[model samples]
Target: MVKWIVKFRNERSHLWAKVVMAIHSGGRSFTTIPIKNSISGVWKNIVQLGKGSSLKLSDVQNRLEVKMGCGDKIFFWLDKWVGDYSLKDRFPDLFAVQTDKFCLVQQRYSLTNGEIVWSWGGESPATHTDMAETWAECVKLLEGVKIEKKSDMWLWKQEDKQEVFKVSDLRSELDGMDLIPET
Candidate 1:
């Protein structure tokens, strides 16, 4: 999706990329051509191809590691980001004391003098004994973080260390799965 136009060229150099992009962006429908009610078998197959992968739960969970660029999409508490664990798991006490458990990465942290801090500004639960320790730990992790002006990238934490999502990689993953042949 980062380079949708150039990336989707086929063997014949036909630019079906637009159609593919539209399918992904426009609710996986026949958006390249206006469709009132019905869909063609070809379109159905195309849509099915996109949804046909049988990803395992562990594999799916492993894939949610977001490469935080600007902290736009990654959920702060719920997602696994830092130290191979979610904030909710790492700091259970803090999560229990948190005002908003569903906050994004950007919401829970703030940049102060080029250092990231665990800040809920108005009413931080730092007064509590347990929360103070949790805040300290969070601050430790946050201080090491470096955010740049870039889009947040949701990555699969499998063999893709570079964090680029590829359909071929998913196909390869599916190929390894043992399946009964259709008669």
Candidate 2:
């Protein structure tokens, strides 16, 4: 599941991933595809794995954070591009008010006269103190980010030096967990 997801994100030209994405979600980000809409067993399973609230899925998902480069493909609120947590999880109040939940990091900001101008989704900025404070923090978090002219990449958080995903590593980690119970 993780392999397929990684392929979908990293290897855009991969035949299997391309075919699955073409048929299942019509080239949309796999994560954005609603589980209810999925028809194929593999597609359904993939969506469930990505969206599931299970501890196993959550733990694995957290390790696969996006490293922003171009920022076109990385989701602003949904993907963990800013820090360890997604903006949605970090600032639920601001997320609740966002106009586009699935907006890209590139869409949230613009290069205006050599300065970065952030535009959070909404008709107008939040006025409520709680949301306002959350908005400020979110902006501050992004102040240091500068999108470069390279494709977005995913980093496996567990791997310190390599920053690469290995099936063996994942297998070992899963094996270490108490997956099977004595009956």
Candidate 3:
């Protein structure tokens, strides 16, 4: 189930991925969409697996890492495109004050007169020292990350050399796991 979702994320241009996105997520990001009760078959099963009491959505997300390029597809705060974790997780205080939580990385910054101009979504009040410090740290991290013309890539965190997705590996992993807990 995690493998399917991971494959969908990594191969957004693939026909199967496109069909799943259109039918399951309604052309929206798979991460943001809610799984409906009416949903059936593979999509429903995958969604249910991710939403299981024991298997969290973060558990699946944590398996993939993003390398931001054009930054259009990568969620600015939600995606683990920069650093070890998402900015929302790393800077909780700033995330709480963020106006647009779903804003893309490209939306946060612009190229103007050959310089990168950052336009933050919300104002961080000066009185909150924690938020202010967090905001500065987040900005400092962003400064070093240059948005380029290349397409963004999502690599499997478990893979050492390539961004390849193998169903056999996932099958072996599942075969070793105890899916049901003895209550």
Candidate 4:
């Protein structure tokens, strides 16, 4: 049997919760034990393990590695594939960790299928307008858009319209608005 500890901290409350799971290599499952308090630093088996059998340390570590790896994969997929446009545009406070390079705000239309696109700020109005129309058409056709990052360009779904617009263009629009700051 092996022991593995997982800890989570609440940023707002500053509270911590720790879970200790014991795994048995032979059984391929965790031991049912309640790790109520950390002060004692003892492993008390809360569940019966068939009359005297307990988990070994090696088993616990293996289980922990497997679980942690699975968690990391899921997190990677969510960050790479999902786009929360409203949150990206309106509530930076809510998602403090999302970066502009990784995500985009949901647009009015969804991109069903298209190639990725990129645009920098301060492009000509004709170019910007064309890009915007293309993007809007993409949204209309695909129903969703995903902004993907590459070494030199951002990729996104779009239609073959004469016009095209990018996130940088949208930022320019926002800047032009000159919205008042909240007091």
Query: In order, how many clashes per candidate?
Result: 0, 0, 0, 26
lDDT of 2 by residue, 113-140 (tens): 9888888696567777877777888899
Best by TM-score: 2
lDDT of 3 by residue, 97-152 (tens): 77677677878888989888767677655346766666777888888887888877
lDDT of each: 0.55, 0.68, 0.69, 0.28
Worst 10 residues of 4 by lDDT: 3-12
Model 2 stretches astray by more than 4 angstroms: 11-34, 37-40, 47-55, 127-130, 166-183
Candidate 2 — what's its lDDT? 0.68
Candidate 4, 10-116: lDDT as tens digits: 11112222232222211222122233333244333422231243333323222221111111111221122224322223333222332222222221123246543
| TM-score per candidate, chains pooled | 0.61, 0.68, 0.66, 0.16
Candidate order (TM-score):
2, 3, 1, 4
Tens digits of per-residue lDDT for model 1, 1-183: 112211331111234634543444333221212222344545445334333445533345455456678676556776776777777778777766566554667776667797666675324648777677667778788677768677576655556364566767666767887776668
Stretches of candidate 1 above 4 Å error?
A: 1-54, 121-124, 158-160, 180-183
TM-score, candidate 3, is 0.66
